[model samples]
Target: SRAEQSRAEQSRAEQSRAEQSRAEQSRAEQSRAEQYLSKTNAQCLKGIFAIAVLCHHMYQYSGLFRGKFGIILQALGYLSVGIFFFFTGYGLIVSYQEKKEFYIKNFLRKRVLPFYLFYLFLTAIYALWRIVLNIEYTRRQLIQSIIFKDALAANSWYLQVIIVFYIFFWITAKVVKDTKKLVRMIIICSMLYCVGCFMLDVTSTRYESFLCIALGTMWAVNKKRVDKLLDIKGLQLFLLSIILFGVFCSTYIIVDNLAIQIFSKMASALAFSSMAIIFVFKLSGRAEVLINNPVTQWLGKYSLEIYVIQGIFLLLRKGTKLYIQNPYVFIVVCVIGTLLLAIVIKSVYDWIVRKCRPQVVNM
Candidate 1:
């Protein structure tokens, strides 16, 4: 009996040591994520994707992508949003690093509050414009337009999906401490997205954006290994190959099956977005000036407002008689004008918030 008790104690001691080792490794990984993606890095990512999605939307409205070469251009919006989700996942880890427990109220308070304020302001304008134009509407539709993302537009569905993901990630982070299981969770979510596409005959970002966000979380969890991989010999060639491969795969759009099409689009988006973000990360210190330009800094700071403000500008363009036929000229002007107007809106919004709710605004 004494010998058996001694053996059991030895096994328990070994197990405890193993668990301690795992906890240490996790702490190191968390530290690495903070190092790899600082607040500044997050801002750079937002600025890049914001301008890109803005351009993609411009092309969509301008009817610029209408032929053999247009599919690649058409595919960029998906890629851009995928990258945006990547940062969103990383951002959650950084922003909530100090929290001892997952708090849904805190997430809603901090994550959704500012955006919801802006959303209420902008979408009300959209609704009123609809009302003035005598567009057929109902009380139900008005309520839906205010609350449901699908009621707003395809692009605007991002807000709904991202908010859902904020909650999802909070739950996941609280429950699953290991990175391996997190990867599996994302893959499962992707499979569910595919099933939803099959059943619904719809393939919106609503179904697919979670995959990218999961990829982002995986990256944050394994940033130490990722940095090491970047330093491997012949990485430049590897980078080039992935970029070309990603672009080539993105152009495959000749399918009748919606499920297959959605699958392909997800693959294409992941390939292209992963390549671009990894490449930018590879640049490290060299791209600082480009990323930190005064204009870029401003764009990053108010990127969300820029996104919301574009709709207002689009409405203004629709109402006015300024006809710019050339897509490039129109996009250039739209970008410049939107940036200027968004800056003004942000300034005024900040001033008002500081006067009334300083803690909420600056928080």
Candidate 2:
């Protein structure tokens, strides 16, 4: 009887261990599944999109890669920006969710001030460059450039949009206590902003990607529910997202009215962003090796610097001997030059931060 009881106890122990092992394995799988848009992955995506933006600007400046290639690059440029906005919205929402008080307390200093300072610095540099080059501009034009009414730098509209979004986010966070209400307000305000931009007859560039930000916010807010609803196999989910993306893109192409096309473009951007997230999540291992490699991570770390500095080069190279005649050569030079300039800017920025830290602490 004693031997039989001991054997039964051992069987129970083995069963318990098996169940624990299965539970742990399930948790590991869940964790991997949720790693779709981790911060690192997001940064890698930013790095990739940053280069896409660069290529788009290059094509705009040089008119290289004619026909379909050029068109595709141009399209990617717009989509790249939508991805950035999506990340911004998602990041802000997740940050607020994780540490409400901390995020709110340092919202301006941590979130807004750096953007303002960098933008101000870039604007000043643009102004100085124009003055040094003796570029003709009326006082009104100069003022407008400074205020972001006109582009002083290549693709400066993005800075204006992001700054506005940051301010809007800060204000909305302060005013709305309920998360659901807050998300609704954000979406409504984003749409209204788009409408205002359209009414002002601003370049389509200014408003087209804005809805992606609201979409990002919505995804972040309802991620759990959405994830649950779409909890099919990874391949199936990926295919579904691709189908959605294709549908939206087709709608964008087929739409007759410019207004409808704009809306469709925004929808397509949202679909693309979703597809990208799914792709990365499903293929995270491969993505880590290929997309999220050291080079991309480094690029992502200095993406903002690269973005701001490349515009200066664009200005400098235009109508000057500095401009490379060969498109291929120009791209090589531009990429290398932008990376070098970005590095220098980052070094200087870091040095300034290091110099200021002690004083800040003392104060």
Candidate 3:
């Protein structure tokens, strides 16, 4: 009888263990689902920002579209950077919400590595092609691009800016634990930073303000809010806001005095911020369908790859003089070509990473 009782007790213990394991598995699955959702939004926002930059560039190099339209498009160009910084801040802060210590390393490991690798690969390809074409090339230019310095004035000034913001944000999020205080400091400093940039006509300093504003805004928004922003049924509000912002900026840009330049610039920046707010709100809300949509979402995922590889298209244009006269055609070709290359390169990179992932995991 005692022996029978022991067997029954052992069976019950095993059943309890199985039940606990199932519960834990369920919780983990839920956690993964949430993370996938978060990453989808981040990718969506980044993809849009990348495309915006591309569009702004198209408008820019197309000499046919000049004057007021030109100025508005040019202003819109910088907003891409603004959107990028905001997403970075939001993504990094939210990522570190649970455990902040590993944020910097993880940022470098996942985001920076892919970027640098792709940059180096494409840069080398461009340099070789340029050499074959007998174009003037320098080791200094290569080094400058690698270090994210102001050496060549390549179209990738934004990449350097991204690296800067990543470091700045990582350090700040690490040191300043108080959320409210950090937000206040970021805002105050961003304003002062903008003032200094405007006074000096310092483009880099202006970019720094974008970083602070983005991170500050991200720190302000939460997960529940993010979901609502992603729901795309409310997209009209976002589109309308963007249009109004554009109009306001165009008006400001046409007024050509020094004081007005400063004010207009400020107005333009504010418009960008306003647009960003609406974008994030809608992105995090019901309008997320646009972002969560399969094609846009996939493009969003690999947008960084597109950013890095797009330079190859620029190099091709410079080398072949293709679509040089027709600005719109040039941009269209460049965009299409860059996207194709990005896909190819990203596929190879992902395969290699997956193959070597065990080593990475061990490390």
lDDT comparing candidate 2 with the true structure:
0.78
| Per-structure clash totals for the candidates | 0, 0, 23
- Which digits, one per residue and each the tens of the lDDT, describe model 1 over residues 1-363? 999999999999999999999999867654543343567766766787788778767766777768865665666677777878778776665444445354433555556655555555555666776555444457776678567624552245677667666666657756765556755675577567657756886646565444677667677666667767765632674577486645546444556665566666666666666676666555555555565567666678877667666764454335434456666777777788878877877875565444443254464
The segments of candidate 1 whose C-alpha lies over 4 angstroms from its true place after superposition are 1-36, 65-69, 102-105, 131-137, 173-187, 233-251, 254-256, 316-333, 344-363
Candidate-wise lDDT, in order: 0.64, 0.78, 0.61
| True lDDT of residue 351, candidate 3 | 63
Q: What's the C-alpha lDDT at position 209 in model 3?
A: 30
Task: Estimate the TM-score of every prediction.
Answer: 0.74, 0.86, 0.68
Q: List the residue pairs that clash in candidate 1.
A: none
Q: Give the TM-score of candidate 2.
A: 0.86
Give Cα distance to truth, residue 332, candidate 3, Å: 4.3
Error of 2 at 32 (Å): 2.3
* RMSD of each candidate relative to the true structure: 11.9, 3.4, 9.9
Ranking of all candidate structures by their TM-score, best first = 2, 1, 3
**Cα lDDT over the full model 1:** 0.64
> Which scores greater on TM-score, model 1 or model 2?
2
